[model samples]
Target: MKKIYLWFTENYLSIIVPLILLLIWESCSRFNLIETKFLPSPSWIIREFFILLSNGELVRNLLISIIRVAEGFFIGVSLGIIVGIQVALNKNLQKSVRFIFGILRPIPVIAWIPVLILWLGIDESSKIAAISIGSFWSVLVSVVQAIRNVDKKYLEVAKVLRKDYKTTMLDVILPSTLPEIFTGIRIGIDVAWRSVIAAELIAASAGIGYMIMYARELFQIDIVLVGVFSIGLTGIVIEELVKVAERHLLRWNTNIYQEEVTRKI
Candidate 1:
């Protein structure tokens, strides 16, 4: 009980500050101290949220956005991991691709929107392409770095044990790089989600971004706020889920790091 209380005390500022600000905003809006037209009260936003919920409009748009993200994320991560491993293992491949990747990687994902719209039209394909483009370079770079940074001593030991390259890569190198690769995956998901939203805002007929855009056109600030908050809340929920998976999957790493820290202490 004491430990739990101490933990809450340590973390109280995070929760309390946000809560206080939200309360103040709600109060100001309700009292007309701040124009509700621009910044609606929390209650107005909640009411608008329920109105959208009852109409099923929010669900449909959210589903479309989620589908685009999933499709792009899976395909991008697959190609990134495979190519990254190949490039890491083969100097020739790395040399051939590195300059091209470096040149293209710095380009912002939003910059590709016009090109994708021209090529794929303002449809699901264009949105997915935007997300894929956004995710691919980041994942590829992270994967390559993770693979290259795997302990060379482990490879030497595997060779001494007469382990085949396939076995060594799958059992030793891949496992060793799992944490970093997953970090890349998390980044990929985040980038893909943002790119998807941007794509939807620019071109798509259906998505949370589209909903917000439409609300703005009609001057319904409450609906716009609902869409904005929904996007932020969903991102946070997905990020938390990723963190939980990371903790469970990387328990071995957590234990190892904890032991090292304890030794230093």
Candidate 2:
């Protein structure tokens, strides 16, 4: 009970502040203290939300957005991990690829929208491409850094045991670098989600982004707000899932790290 109380206390501000702001907004709108044109009341938004929910439009659009994000994120993370590992293992490869990545990494994902549309015809392919490009660099950089930062002592011990490169990498390097790789994957998913939404806003016929864009076009502020809130909520849920996955996969490392911290203390 005490632990539960402490947890609630720690998280009270995060929960209370949002609730307070929402209540204030709803109150102001209900009392006509604020113009409904620009700021729709929570009740009005809730009604519209129910309407969209009943009609299944919201779910449909949400599913489409989720599908695009999943497709793009998986592809980007896979390629990024492979490339990152390769570069980290080979000094020559790292040097050769550095110039290209340096130039491409700084370009905003939205900047590719026009070119992708032209090349891929404003279809799912273009949107996926945009998301992939947006997420790849961040994941690649994170994985590379994680691999590079792996403790050299592990490699030395593996070598002393006559472990081959593949064995060493599988047992030592991959495990040691997993936490960093997972962090990168978390960030990559965020970038992919944002990039996919932007792409969908520009060209998609069915997606949360499309719904938001359509709402904006029809001057339905409530629908727009619903879409915004939906995005934020979805992002938070996905991030939590990633954290759960990280915990499961890195359980061993977590114990080791905790023990080391205990020793230090």
Candidate 3:
């Protein structure tokens, strides 16, 4: 009993809350405290989840959503990093583009849905474009800010070492700005991921967003809950993957405590 308690204490985060919630949910459903049709029990939802999985519909839609997010996120982050770095390094370019970006950045992501639909039509292109736009500005702003805020002392040291522009940027500026850039990328991806539902809602025939919409229309709350759970769970997994990659790639920049934590894991 003591060993079991110790094990649970060590792994509390991964277990306790979920276990409590599941117990409460199951009890409520068993007692009919809540309408089963509207809010199915965890067991029923799990059953529906397995049914969808076995039929392959869930996997197919998940893959579609993942593909859309990847395409849009890649484009947005690539362009954002390149443009932000160029503008930050060149005073003249910064002056030329700052006002334009300032004017354009305030427009909300959803506002582009209509225009994208008109330009690209009600297809994958439009959806991808919307997600890309949603991610781009956030990443651009973060990259530009990170680069701009780099320590002048570091630049001076690089100058003293006779580092060329390319060398200075590659060895000094980029390394210093990496943490912020990673943060930006994470935020941008999150925005892009969330925007998938809205983008697909425009006219998508497949994807998690479409599945949720269809389930809602059919009043299949169990399926709807499954879709919502999938979205949140997928998002968490993606974010953790990005963080792990970042930790591996930028291990030198990580704090000592974080490094120790990683080692323990």
Candidate 4:
């Protein structure tokens, strides 16, 4: 009990702030301080969330969305890192792709939905493509900028040691850039989420975005809010997962660097 109490004391603020806000929101809704149409009572949304969950609609749609995000994020981030490194290091490579990427990158990924629908059709392919494209830019730009921003001093150290291209990149450039690259990856996640939703809203017959849009059409605002909350909550979960992975990987990186320095000395 004491341990639980201590844990609560440490973590209470995080819980309490949202709880307080929910109370205020519930009061407003109950008192009609805010219309139930625009801002449904917390209780109503919770009730709807459970109803959807019990009926398996929410789980099915959420699972579908999760799979789509996983596949698209993997493909997009893999390509982004591979291309970003080459473009950053190889002027010739940059020259080849720069013109087209420059033209295409300026356009928002959401704007490509109509064209994607036309080319790929309103199926999983089109939606996944939308997510991949949306996830690409943030990571690509992050990697490219990270390489450019690598401390010249590190390069000077590599030169002094006469490190080969592959060795230098593996040991120096990558470690130097991982943090920034991860930052971009974090941004790409949000983009990926938004892209999936937009694609679903526009063309999908299923998924969370479709659920929200369908609810809107029927003027089921409580259901709409439930979908909105589901998306937000799930997005938070995904980001937290990434952050946990980042912390572990970064800690490992630090250990590797220390071992290398110690060995050299």
Candidate 5:
């Protein structure tokens, strides 16, 4: 009883709200208070999830979306980092890159779908292009700004030392800007992953987004909810993975700061 009370105290709000909502939802479904077509019960969605999983349909579609995200994210973030580095290192190229990408920045990932389809056709290439654009812009903007906002004192000292742009970028800017670059990567990957669903939903014949859209057309609310839940859970997992990578890779930064503090003390 004591353990139970402690557990409840620790997990109450998080567990209770969703439990109550599910209970209410289930009751509504059982009593016909809500149309099954519009809002299927929690149990129905869960059962459908298991059914889809057993048949491999859910896994297959999810894999397709994940693959698309991987390919596009690699292309986009790689380009973003490369271009950002060049832009920071060269004034002439910086102006050209900034102007070109800036004009294209406001256009959204979903918005690019139609243009991509028309240019590349309604195929995997277009879908990947849409996802890539989403990632590229996010990382590009973050990387450029991260460099621009690098601790001014370092830049000032570098300038006084007559450091060239390349030297300053390599010695002073790169180290300081890594954290922000990681942040950009996290955001860019999330954006690209999200774009996969929309790209597939809008045009493709396969993928998680297509599954949801297809289920909606068939009036299978449970399946639609299952797909949505899959996306949400996958997103949470992706975010946590990025955070773990960031902490691991930047662990040295933490040690350096601690050493500096200890010296001052």
Candidate 6:
């Protein structure tokens, strides 16, 4: 009981508010405060979710969306990192490419879907294209900023040690910018997921966004709610996974201060 209490205390932000909202929603449904036709209770939504799952509709759509995101994220992040490093290290390249990015970056990912669809057709390729484009800019900008933010002192130290250009970049610049790169990755993944959903909503026959849109057209509000809930829950899980990976990869930097304190103790 004590452990349960402690766990609740630790996770209150993630738990208590959602529980309260669920209870309020359930109460509203019970009291007929809202028309069930428009807004079903949380319990009804949960039941619909299970029904969809058992029929494999939810799982199939979810898998399709995940695959699209994974493909786009991998491609976008790789290109972003490579291009960001190249541009950051070369002043002439940065200046040459600045205008192109300035014009492109402000455009919303959804706006690109029509163009992408025309180029790649209303298929997985089009969806992936939209996701990649949306995610790429986010990651590129972050990586450039992170590289630029690297300490001058570190550069000087590297020079003092007579490190070659390759060594300096790999050891000093790369390591110093890892935290910000990971931040970019997190942001990029979010952009990728959102773009994929928008693409699916626009054209694809299978995805969480498609599920929600189809349910809405059929006036199955509970199923729409289930799709929304599933999307939100999946996003949370993915973001948490990214955070865990970030912590693991950057553990040397994150734990250095803690290690020093421990030694003192």
Selected candidate, larger lDDT, 4 vs 5: 4
Per-residue CA lDDT of model 6 for 1-265, tens digit only, reads 9999999899999887889989999999999998998999889999999999999999999898999999999999999999999999899999999999899999999999999989999978999888899889888998999989987866776677777888777767787788899999999999998998899889988888899899889999999999888988898899999999988878785467335323322
Could you give candidate 3's per-residue lDDT for residues 43-76 as a string of tens digits?
9999999999999999999999999999999999
Highest lDDT model number? 4
> lDDT tens string, model 1, 1-265?
9998999999999989999999999999878899888888998899989989999998888888888999998888888898889999899999998899888999999999999999999878888888888888778888899988877866776777788878877777777788888889889889998998899888877899999899899999999989988888888877888889988977776467545333322
| TM-score quality measure for candidate 5 | 0.85
> How does model 4 fare in lDDT?
0.89
Question: Model 1 segments beyond 4 Å from truth?
Answer: 1-10, 254-265
Q: For residues 127-234, what per-residue lDDT tens digits would candidate 5 score against the true structure?
A: 999988999988887888888887687677778778787776666777678799999999998899889999988888999999999988998888999999999888
**lDDT values, one for every candidate:** 0.86, 0.88, 0.87, 0.89, 0.86, 0.88
- Candidate 1, 107: how far from true, in Å? 0.9
Q: State how far residue 9 of model 3 sits from its true place (Å).
A: 4.2
Q: Judged by lDDT against the true structure, how good is candidate 1?
A: 0.86
Report the Cα lDDT for candidate 6.
0.88
**How does each model score on TM-score?**
0.90, 0.92, 0.88, 0.89, 0.85, 0.92
Q: Give the alpha carbon lDDT tens digit for every residue of 35-110 in model 4.
A: 8887789999999999999999999998989889888988889989999999999999999999999998878878
Question: Which residue pairs overlap in candidate 3's backbone?
Answer: none
**Cα lDDT of model 2 by residue, 120-239, tens digit:** 997789999998888898889999999889778667767777888887777777877888899899999999999988998889899999999999999999999989888989999999
Two-way lDDT contest, 1 vs 4, winner: 4
Point out where model 3 deviates above 4 Å.
Answer: 1-11, 254-265
Error of 1 at 221 (Å): 1.2
> Worst lDDT window (10 residues) for model 4?
256-265
Q: What TM-score does model 3 achieve against the real structure?
A: 0.88
Q: How much is 212 displaced in model 2, in angstroms?
A: 0.7
Query: Is 5 or 6 the stronger prediction by TM-score?
Result: 6
